[model samples]
Target: GLSLEPILLALCEWGQHHADELNEMDRLADCIIRPRQARQPAIA
Candidate 1:
């Protein structure tokens, strides 16, 4: 429906505006996750 189109577009624009903030959060999350992933012994 047309109603959802505006809402979806607004949400997409908002995400674009906050792209850097989102990427920073992703980097922080990866820092937390990567160490745990690295700790596991390799399955050679």
Candidate 2:
């Protein structure tokens, strides 16, 4: 199996440096995902 700690740390550092872009992407992803989530029934 692959070790994820270093990968996640790198990603965190990258995110810190590129938060604005990440936020924009998150907003875009939410726009795309929300509609599908809305159409689906809530299940627990």
Candidate 3:
């Protein structure tokens, strides 16, 4: 209950602190994935 609140809050704060880095990672992942997705032909 209350015990987990502090840990969750801390985790949220940590995530916020690394938001930029996380966003960059997300962008890089998308960049890598998109080309691979595009290269694959869709089945009819």
Candidate 4:
């Protein structure tokens, strides 16, 4: 699972320097974390 704390902190820092680009990067990060699926193995 992705940790939102560090991401949010980094985004805040980036936003201070590059607000527009940070917005786009935030969108991309959202997409990247959405489709992850966990796997389980069957026992015989």
State the C-alpha lDDT per candidate. 0.51, 0.49, 0.51, 0.56
Model 2 C-alpha lDDT per residue in residues 1-44, reported as the tens digit of each score:
13555676677666655766656545332211111223667799
Q: Model 2, which residues run further than 4 Å from truth?
A: 20-44
Task: Please tell me which predicted candidate would have the highest TM-score against the true structure.
Answer: 3
Task: Provide the TM-score for each candidate, comma-separated.
Answer: 0.41, 0.38, 0.43, 0.34
lDDT tens readout by residue for model 1, 3-38: 466676676666655766667545331211111223
Candidate 2 or 1, higher TM-score = 1
lDDT of 4 by residue, 1-44 (tens): 54575686677666555746555655443312243466778789
Residues 1-44, model 3: lDDT tens digits:
55566676676666655766667535332211111223568799
How much lDDT does candidate 3 score?
A: 0.51
Clashing pairs in 2: none
Better candidate number, 2 or 4, judged by TM-score: 2
Model with the higher TM-score, candidate 1 or 3: 3
Residues forming the 10-long window of minimal summed lDDT in candidate 4: 27-36
Clashing residue pairs in candidate 3, if any? none
Off by over 4 Å in 4: 19-44
